[model samples]
Target chain A: MRWEGRAWVFGDNVDTDQIIPGRYLRRVSYDELGRYAMTGADPEFPEKVREGDILVAGRNFGCGSSREQAVMALQQAGIACVVAESFARIFYRNALNRGLPTVEAREDPTEIVEDGERVVVDLDELVLRSESGEVPLREPPEFARRAWREGGLLELARRNPERPPWR
Target chain B: MATVVERFLSEKCGERVEAGDVAVVEPDVIMLHDGSGATALRTLRELGTERVKRPDRVVLIFDHSVPPSSVEAANRQNELLAFARRHGIERVHVDEGVCHQILVERGYARPGRVIFGGDSHTPTAGGVAALGFGFGGTDMAFTLLYGELWLRVPRTIRVHVTGDLGPGVTAKDLALTIVGELGAGYADYAVLEYTGLPERLPVGDRMCLCNLATEAGAKSAYVPPAEGPERLRPGDADETVELDASEVEPVVSVPDAVDRVRPVGDVQGEEITRVFVGSCTNGRYRDIRAFTEALDALGGPDPNVRIVVVPASRRVLLRLARDGTLERLIELGASVAPPGCGPCLGEHLGVLGDDDVCVSTANRNFPGRMGSVEADIYLASPLTAAVAAARGELADPREELPRTALERVSGS
Candidate 1:
């Protein structure tokens, strides 16, 4: 599958609070939630973000909290994909379970793709092509990619109504 | 041929499974709190379902914002009550401190069972040999509707702890030592399998280790069950680390990073403005009793230092109240907040002002964790926290305790 988006660059250790602070956790408003996405690290981030924009960052991205809302808030704001050098384990899993594509490239995407540079993400051939050059991407385990392909675990369950013990 | 985590996953999946396998398995317990319960339920409802698949397997906890801190919080709780009623989820606990504590007290967590909650510290249940981990609200919603979740089998990292702890060297200190020795990201995407004389460490102490595993980027922590519950040894470790508990000193996780730990002596006498002595990490009977006892011995804290004690659960509070321990803590100048996660996450309770420094018993000292991003949070044990509050500075508790009391651990 092919994906296209502009890169929204961030530095290392971009925590969940930075994605969306703890103060907004009690409520359930997508618009209200989207207004605060990335506000901690960049106050004008919410307004600057556009639909189908990809978030690019360094190591330990989304390094705090089990709150799935952080990923959901980004998804709501139309964050097409997140490519990081490394990700907090839970955040990586959370994004997948929510059907949001996340790629971990050995080569730091932040160095290859600059801010607002439109790049193409290829899941089929395992490559990220930008005007600068073509950077190879490591494909996640097949099961994880399958979940993403199916649009998340919830969608996967809808396909297999029998639940576990797939007899 | 399978490790403990793999075996547990296999059992839950109703078939033999291997490491590196990803499958959806319905866990025995699915816990949620006021902060995320409504979202989970709403997600399930939006999926075109009004009834939960198994209400008996779900628990709703109202500990994050108890006693109605605001109208919004109150409205959220009311909606949660209605949602819980519409469905058959009868296992609801209000003012029960934290969901992790309630998960154990309600007998929902035990050895060999897979437990999932919406909070990160849910892995605290692993201290009791249960396979507990955290998930997001959407996953919780899916689990609530179908009683299962899709999970990736995490690689196991065996942590073998040796030696007996010396004077005032508790499990909290050992955890800090391990976090410091091994970087916070050492256990990333891995499961921590703790072995070697684990029974010597009580449930509370073991929970402390598992609770802090998140800071080390661990997906989960497990202490295999000792009884009839089947035990599976970990597979060939991707990595191994050995720790000598006796060598551990009372340490602290300074502001801005959970892994950046140093001996308390290094940062001692730093004037403290506030102190908190509770959270799932160190808010059990063992911890609170230790702090209150330390206060009694030290003649309580200085009036200038702000101190708040939050019981981990309603059951813990009752246990202390029944034994006259609660009154003693109150009389000693501790402003006891209702049983819940008070002030740990920097909500309406005990928020720190700018430039303030707080010594706390909770996990993680990340920026803005307690309140202001500029304020510093020093993570320590309850005894150390009480001492800091009493002394109005970050002083080591070992210096004040009697030498006899500082003797070897009870089991050792």
Candidate 2:
């Protein structure tokens, strides 16, 4: 799978609260949640975001809260993919579980990718291309890649129904 | 040698596993709270799963939005209740306590067991030597349908705690100091195995230590079994951090960053508008009692400040009531909220307003955590929080409370 979009850059430790505050958690619908995505970090984020935008961030992209809404909010906001220097464990898992592509760039993408610059993410080749240069991305595990291909674990679960793939 | 987590996961999987290996295992307990349950139920419906595989293993607690802070929250909770009824899941708790506290208090989290909850603070079960951690709603839904989940076994980091805590210094201070030293995300995808804690340390303090491990990006945290052969060897961990409890001063995490810690003296005299002492982090009975005792010694909170105290659970509240701690706190001008996560996540009951400065004992202090983004939150121990309440500003607990009072509160 591949994605091509404009880059939206953020600094380190962008916690789940910053992605979507706890107050907005009462709203369960993903579409409604999209309106508040990244509003905690920047109030104008929802309005500034366009469909098929790629987020470029520094280390520890999703630091706090195990709320899957953080991942859902970004996906619902039309973020095609997230490329970060690193990611918190739960958020990384949630992203894949929700069929959202997350790439851990070998180098800090925030240092190379400018805000609003066009970027391309090639999951098959594990490489991220921006105007500055190409940044290599760590290869995700086979299971994770499969989950992304299957459009999340829900579809995988539906296919099996009787047992999980691991079992 | 296998680390404690490796051993625990091995037991669950009925096969030997190590760090970096993926294992499919069944958890002894699956916890869901109001915050994550509705989403999981929705995903379960989407999956077209009609029945939960192991309804008996599921535990549902309503604590995050207890009493339903708004119409939307109420509607979501109602949906959860209806789903629970339809599934025939029997272990359901409402407005009882935070899910983490209730899990341990009810004995669902035990030594050598594997537990999974929908909240990050689920590592609070590590206090009992259980291997517990958080999962997302979609993953939780899949687990509910299949009765098992796959996990990558995590490497272990040993936090070697030693020495005795000084007067007025509590576990919360030590937790902050550790997080400050290690930085957030230091333990990402790893298990923090806390060793060398004094056996006499109360279970509540142990819980506090494990609760904040989430801030450091730990997948889980564990304390060695009190009386068992499943001990962690010296070199079992990938890394080790030495921390002397006596050297830990009363510290606070400044606004917007859980790891941005400073000594209380460094930020002393900063005026505060609110003081909160509660949540899964420090809402245990001992914390409330310690706060009340310190506040009593200081002659009650300042008139200009609003002090809100929340118990971690109904049982903790009942204990305080039986010991007169609850009455004394009310007499001292504290408004006691129900036994749940009050204002910790900024949903209801003491949400801070713009420009509000609060000293809270909850876990996270990120922007808009307890209210307005402009509000500044200082995360500290109950003792320091009590002092801030009394002075209406950040103050050193050791300077305010008598040594005897401090010792008594610290259980030193």
Candidate 3:
């Protein structure tokens, strides 16, 4: 998938509280969640966001709460993809399992791309390009990439349980 | 090395274990929340499982969406009743309390064992020395199908706390502080073993430590069986064939602090928009007393803050009520919620508004963690929370606790 979007920059350890906030969990509907995405960290986030916007963040993105709602909120917000330095394990798996494209931004994408700067994400090449330069977003470790390509290991196993290649 | 808990689950349950693999344990108890119980019951019927291998191992708790907030929820409760009766898995905790609070107060989770539930914070069982984690509904259904489940043995990270917390820091503060430094997913598939703080903390605080293990991106967190002059429990070995404790120092790839940190900034924020004083983390009688004492010291909390006190169990609630603690809190503006999840899951009552900011003693302050997708939740100790509730913002409680209160909290 090839896509381009402007980046929404966030700093280190951006926790789940900032992403979805715990209070709206009871709402349950995806639309309600989308409206409040990142309200804690940036109150105007929902209104300011546009479709195909990429979330650019530092380490531990999506850290806290395994609730799938956090992912749904971002997806519903029309987040094209999330590129972070690293991710919480469960959140990373949940993101990929739900079919949201996520990549680790290698070499500070911060210097090359700014908030609202026109940028392109090339999933095939795992590269990001802007006015400054082309930067490679770290590809998921082999196993995770395989899992991502195969629609998550659990789904893969369910579809072809007998030929479990990982086994 | 595999922990004894891991070795036990691995040897007993034939699953190739990895630290992060979520396991479905045949819950010695199955607690359901509101309409969720109905979902569990319906799934059970569809699976057509005959005779639960251990009927005694299940518990149905109806704490979420309780008092039947809606007709649909009430209908779900009836279905739960029918299922409980059909399966003979009695010990159903109804609208009386929250599931995690009730389980601990009622002794369903004892030291040194394992427990699983449909909710993720099942790690709250760590308060009583049990391995707890959340499971998928299908996984829970499968547990009913077969009494066993699979797991990945996780490597353990030992976090040693030395010296005493500088002041105002609670177990919640320590846990949050650690998670803050560790960057959430730093130790993705590890068991965080908190050690070397026996002289500085009580069993309650230790429980709080382990209960929030999930927040740090670890599968679970633990404390080596407490040893000391108070002798809360008896003699324990530092080593076992399954795992050895004494040999390890408190270590994590992420650093917690050069030392304990104070609040984020000098200003104590503003009047708390909300106050949450219960969870598997610190919802026990001890936590209750700590909170009340801090509240009393502040001459009760500010009028603006909405304090919600949820007991982990009916027993804890009963104890609080009998001791007049519940009455005191209520008089001071604390709303005593039923014995189950209140603000923890943002499920039932006590949800935060987008404009609200909370000071809570529960684990994790992740976005959308409390209930509102827009509210901000801050993690602090029970004392800190109590003081914050009274002071109308975050303030270290160590300065306010009477020497006697401090002594009792320290379990000295």
Candidate 4:
């Protein structure tokens, strides 16, 4: 799916805590999760995040704690996709399983997108657009993309077992 | 040639993994955590590597956010299970217990051996007297595909603990104390060897020390094998070794100490908010007992503090019930999360609120570690953590718990 919204850029190692804190975990529902999205990093995130909003971050984007709650919090908050220089492996999988797409590319999003600047993300074409310019970004692995489209890897494997060739 | 881990670290920037001048390559067991299993399997499939190499030597765990707080999370864990089945890895332990916790109880982790895992906390296994280190998904994949993994023999730093720990103090505190002093990246690529006190420290304390070695950025950590009153003993000692554990004093330095320890308070602290107890590191019976003893001493938890305790394994949970420790914890107002990861990761039961402060016994207090980046995390010993939980503030419990509990636990 393609989405576009203002961008929120973060620095490297923006851990799961900054995305969603543990104290809020007592309430597990996604509805409550969105309220805590980036709440630690940005308290006003819930009210400010618009549908289709994209989060761009630096390296180690989801380091610390392997809680999938961070992914849920972001997706439930209406975050369309995350573009980071790198992603903690667990968080990367957690994102794909929940149908939240993440990409790893070397370019700095801070240079191209500001806190409130409009941006567009295209998963199919693997490109990001903002007022500053359009940039080519790395795409999620093929299986990951297929997984996202089919609701997750398991469903994708169930429907098209031979699709990725790896399976 | 640089080892798979070293090469990958070199290629991946930002994380900045550098190979040391001397590479130590010895691993008795290879542990894989969560999505890393799937990744390793896929890498094997792609590489068409043969034999899957000693499936018995591998241990797989699902501790990292895969216990399924939601349908999606559950599905992901299912995929991991399927992947392991396909790979023919017999040592798979999924959603059963924390990896380090189970390894020690199951006796899969032995001291003086090399150990590796895809999860960073693999170093925690060293508590059982193994050389524990963590690698990435690709490295895990490479290792499983080929029985041998390359390495950069790291300069060994030996920390000698000679003095008796005060009451309520534990290896968890020792680890936190070291990490707090060393800061997160002090030992970036070093191998830490903890020695001294075979009779003084319990097995749980050793695990806590080795577990937090990663916090100091050490590549891997170990405590020299010593003959305990148990079945385990330090293996053959090499004569060429430069450092002698016996000669060192009871001191810790980010450098001078075998494993540099950076104090949590010095690294940075913001405010007081929530406290968590559990995870593979400090989630054993001993860990829980420490917390309970502290809580009992304090009478109960403070009104404002939100304390959550998760037993490491079902066995542990049952044991606590049988011993009435569970009732006391519940009565004391400590919320007992299901025997899994609980709040260790933000996936289940309890998540942290925005801008909250969390003190936990689990390793890695990184952003969102307890659930929010805006929230600050402080790593501390179980005693510190227990006392903090009881008073609803961060306080070391060395001065709190009775001396009887401090008596070195036999058989560790």
Top candidate on DockQ is 2
After superposition on all C-alphas, the RMSD of every candidate to the true structure, in Å, is 3.0, 1.6, 6.6, 9.5
> Candidate 1 chain A — worst ten consecutive residues by lDDT sum?
A158-167
lDDT of 3 by residue, B1-412 (tens): 4554564455445564544555444445554554344544544554444345566877677776666655556676787787778878888878666666666667886656567666556666665566665553434544554554444456666665665554344555566556555545655666666666532466567667666667666666566565423222222222212222222211111111111234544435555778888877777777877788779877988878888888766778888889998888878878888766667766556877778888776665555566555566776667777877887876545555566666655521
Where is model 2 chain B poorest over a 10-residue stretch in terms of lDDT? B226-235
Model 1: how far residue B150 lies from native, Å: 2.1
Candidate 1 structure quality by residue, lDDT tens digits, B85-165: 888789989886788888877788877789888877777887887888787777777777777777778888888888877
Per-model B-chain TM-score:
0.95, 0.98, 0.80, 0.78
Select the stronger candidate by DockQ from 1 and 4. 1
Clash number for each model:
2, 0, 36, 57
Model 2: DockQ vs. true structure: 0.71
Stretches of model 1 off by over 4 angstroms after superposition: A1-6, A111-135, A141-167, B225-238, B408-412
Worst 10 residues of 1 chain B by lDDT: B403-412
lDDT of 4 by residue, B1-412 (tens): 3332333223322243444532334356888765456555544454454345667678887765535665545665687677667768777776667777777777777754567677767777666666666664545665665544545545455565565554344565555565555555456556666766632566777777787776566666666445653323332221112322222222222211123344333333234567788887778887787678767877777777788888887778888899999999989888887666677666566677766777777776655555545555665655666666666655434344455644432123
Give the TM-score of chain A in candidate 4. Answer: 0.86
Q: Native contacts recovered by candidate 2, as a share?
A: 0.69
Best candidate according to TM-score: 2
The alpha-carbon lDDT assigned to residue B238 of candidate 3 equals 28
**Distance (Å) between predicted and true CA of B92, model 2?**
0.8
Clashes of 3: 36
Q: What TM value does model 2 have?
A: 0.97
Residue A140 miss distance in model 4 (angstroms): 26
